[model samples]
Target: MQHRPIKTAVFPVAGQGTRFLPATKAVPKEMLPVVDKPLLQYAVDEALAAGIERLVFITARGKGAIDDHFDMASELVAGLKARGKTAELASLEGTCLEPGRITSIRQQEPAGLGHAVWCARHIVGADAFAVLLPDELLWNPARPALAAMHDAYRQMGGNIISVLEVTEAHTHRYGIVTPGRSDGLLTEVRGMVEKPQVGTAPSRLAAIGRYILQPEVMDVLAKGRRGAGGEIQLTDAMAELIGVQPFHALTFEGTRFDCGDKVGHLMANVALALERSDTGPALRDWLRSLEL
Candidate 1:
């Protein structure tokens, strides 16, 4: 059977970045820069690279800056053009979404991941769409992570989620998956346990932020049942779709940073900076000089 092509992607950016505190008071956490570009930009670029033609952003009241970020900065572009800053001008390329390719809908309240995703139901309609959480930044420029999952979706023809092995001690921090039939990086997902209790956890393979879900998930979320943390959890909705549809997890080949945490954010910057030819030498020198 041919799989429904994933032409649209939903970005759930409505969360209040309470973890970042005062810095996120005025800015959305997704707007926080990794090196120079904001976290949201990386997620958008990844979606576009994976052949996603339309972007559906689930945002809240304070996320207007995100809307502005994707809009063309005419004055700034003119300034760079006059100065003949060719490189800078080139850097801004591919930042703007063409015409009607992007849509943003408000969540209205701080519900949860499932609720945030449900906000884009009308826009997503009845198509298979990918969901990317900007907080999870997967670094693999050679082949974008989402593209890999899309490839698996074509072969497997079901819901595909990105998974990574975490230590047993950290199992409770993520949505743990029960492994079934395994084939290299791809594993058949028997079930998913959201933030399982430490001792009772199923497996070490934890689900990450990437997902290619069928439209039936919206129907599950419509039930409005609250799960862990007393909020509507996306994992809960996904679990409902497991038996009804083919569900599998892909161990994405890449370095994933949980940018939602302070340490992870810092690590992403240092790691990406070290990979840049221009900044690597200076950054390496500075790091070596530090007395840790």
Candidate 2:
């Protein structure tokens, strides 16, 4: 079957980031620096790489900083250009968001992930769309995780969520997929259980942050049924679509970091730091010095 094109993507960034606390008091956690870039920039680049034209950010109050991040820095760009700082100009240029290509909706309440996604339904309209969780930093050399999934989406439609093998012990932390047949690196999803009990999991394939879902998912999320932790969960709504739609899981070639968690945040920074040309050698030396 010829898969439908994905023109838009929904980014849910409404969380209060209470986990990071004081530091996140004024600064949005998405703006927290990871090496040279912020968390949200990584997600935005992933969406753009997947040929997404419209970017919808589901935000809450005090998220003005995120909106400002992509806005044109006219005076700053001009100053850099006047000083013949070409590299600086280039850095600012990459931050530009095409006029009107970006839009925001207030999630208002600190509800579940499903509610946040539902807020952006109108922006996504009636078509297949990608949804990327900014906290999940997917690193890839060939194609970003979303782009790889889009490639799979060319053959399979309905809903495509990225899956990575997580330890059975960690299954309770993620939405685990019950695998059916394998399609290249993609797996046909027989069903999904959000945070299933240990030893009772259908499979070790845990749902990551990337997803290419049909607009029909909007209908499911609209019902806003509270799940898991009292908030309406996205996983619960996605579970409702399994057998009904042609759902599948794409095994993306990338290392994913749950940047929302403390340990995961530290891991992403250290891993990316070691990948830098100038810092790689020194960082490696430091790691060797630690000796475990």
Candidate 3:
């Protein structure tokens, strides 16, 4: 059965990035830069690559900077054109989305992931849409994980979530998926447990940031039931749709960096820099020269 095309992608950027502390005090955590582009840009570009027609940012009061970052700076463009700076102008191309193609909704409160997603329900109205958490940066320029998940959604015609294996000890840190059957990278998600107590995890496979969810999920999220951490957990809402709808997880082939963590954020910068042609050689040499 063919499902509705996923044209809208929702980004939850309302969180207070307490983990980064002072740096995030004045800036949205999603604005944090890795290498060069902000974390949110990578997620936005990935969503656009997956054929998403519109972008919806679920934001909070202090997150206006996220909106400003995407707005076209006419003066900057004019300066570049006048100075004949084509390279610099080209860099901004990826940051620009056509007018009306992107919009934002105020989450109003720090409810939780489920609540954040529900904030965009009106825009996503009665359609299948993709959800991307910018903090989970997946490095795979050749084939973005979201694009791959979109491809699967076309054939499978149901909810598709991106997942990867975490260490057994780290299972408590993620939503553990219970597998019914598997073929290669795809697995039937029989059920899932959110932040399962250490040793009680059902499986080592943990759901990551990318998701292609149907409209019914918005209804589930609307209930605002709290779980795990006394917050509206999206995982619980997703679990409710399992047997009622087709649900599966794709074990994406790419390196993931939890940019929410300082160490992970630093690691992402180094990893991406070392892989770039313009920076790799020098960066690699410099890394080798380090005494650590």
Provide C-alpha RMSD values for all models, in order: 0.9, 1.5, 0.9
Residues 14-129, candidate 1: write the lDDT tens digits.
98899999999999999999888899999999999999999999998789999999999999999999999999998887679688999999999888999999998898887899
Across residues 1-292, which tens digit of lDDT does each residue of candidate 3 receive? 4598899999999999999989999999999999888999999999888889999999998898899999998999999999999989998976878899999999888888999999999999988999999999987988999999988888788899999999999999998999989988889999999999989999999999889999999899988899988999999999999999999999999899999999999999999998889889999999899999
List the candidate 3 regions with Cα displacement exceeding 4 Å.
Answer: none
How much is the lDDT of residue 248 in candidate 1?
96
Clashing pairs in 1: none
Cα deviation at 210, candidate 1, in Å, is 0.1
Cα lDDT for residue 48, candidate 1 = 92
Q: Whose TM-score is higher: candidate 2's or candidate 3's?
A: 3
